[model samples]
Target: GFVYAVTTADLYIRGGLANRVLVIGSETFSRILDWSDRSTCVLFGDGAGAMVLEAGEGAGSIADHGVLAASLRSDGAHKDKLFVDGGPSTTGTVGHLRMEGREVFKHAVGMITDVIEATFSAAGITAEDLDWFVPHQANKRIIDASAKKLGIAEQKVVVTVDLHGNTSAASVPLALSVAVADGRIKKGDLVLIEAMGGGFTWGAVLVRW
Candidate 1:
């Protein structure tokens, strides 16, 4: 959802549909979780994060303010790998989250890094050019694997999973906020953001901060 939010805002700005857009990613996984299920219950927490994007004039280079490039992708084939067991229309009740953790982890790093590379290609930049890589706060292992695969330095990745748990949609933005607040991300910095979610949905966004 964080990737979806940022991509949608970027598209709107590029399409002349809007000048400034507010994108938010929030989730309350606790409400739907089966507390008895430790696997899913203990891994998530409720949280929200937001950002406002405004139009800016640039020289059509990588130095452009706001979003420079983005890539969004989804695969329904892996939908059952991580999902809830019930839905309002299907089961008439909100259901507990269920997941095949090992299976999802196996595909996550590759899926995430693929989109990040695509975004870098689209922006005419590389991981070496990034000042920060803020990925979804799903877990330390996934975050570490993705960064390592992309060759993005450990110092460049913004991680907040330890402090916030897996806030689902809120992960990226929350991590970004932390990086920015602590001075790791700053003016003119090139930042890369990415996420992979339950529907097997995933995407990446490149921005000049």
Candidate 2:
């Protein structure tokens, strides 16, 4: 979700459609959750995030201080593994969130690494070249496993799930904000933002900030 926003903003900025774009991702999972269902309800949190992307001039190289590359993918075959049970048109109700937690974790790691690798390849760099990796704050096991598989060091990964349970669409931007506010992410640093969510959606966006 965050990757899609960033990439879309990049397109508008580069295409001369807009000088700046305010991309915001806000979610209120608590409202849609069934509080009685501890399994899925407790795993979510309410949060919102906003980012402003403006036009910038660069040398047209990998060193550009903006969105460099992005890779997005979605597979509905596994949609039932992670999704809400109701919707307005389908069920005439906003249903509770439902998921097969174990099944999601199994696919999350593989799907995440696949798209991230594609982004890295498109930008002609590897995990070692990234200054920081801010991934979806969904699960610690999945986050750690994905990084380990991609060869990204532990210290370079920005984590906040321990602090903020999963914020859905707000995960990446929230983590990015935390890292930035703490002085971890800084100017000219190569950062990679990745996320996986309901609908079996996943994506990776590389930026030089």
Evaluate residue 96 in candidate 2 and report its C-alpha lDDT on the 0 to 100 scale: 74
Alpha-carbon deviation at 166 in model 1, angstroms: 0.3
Off by over 4 Å in 2: 88-94
Report clashes for each candidate as comma-separated counts.
0, 1
TM-scores, all candidates, are 0.95, 0.95
lDDT for model 1 comes to 0.89
Encode model 1's per-residue lDDT on 60-88: one tens digit a residue.
88878888899999999998999987665
lDDT agreement with native, every candidate:
0.89, 0.91
Residue 133's lDDT in candidate 2: 100
Candidate 2, residue 21: the lDDT equals 93
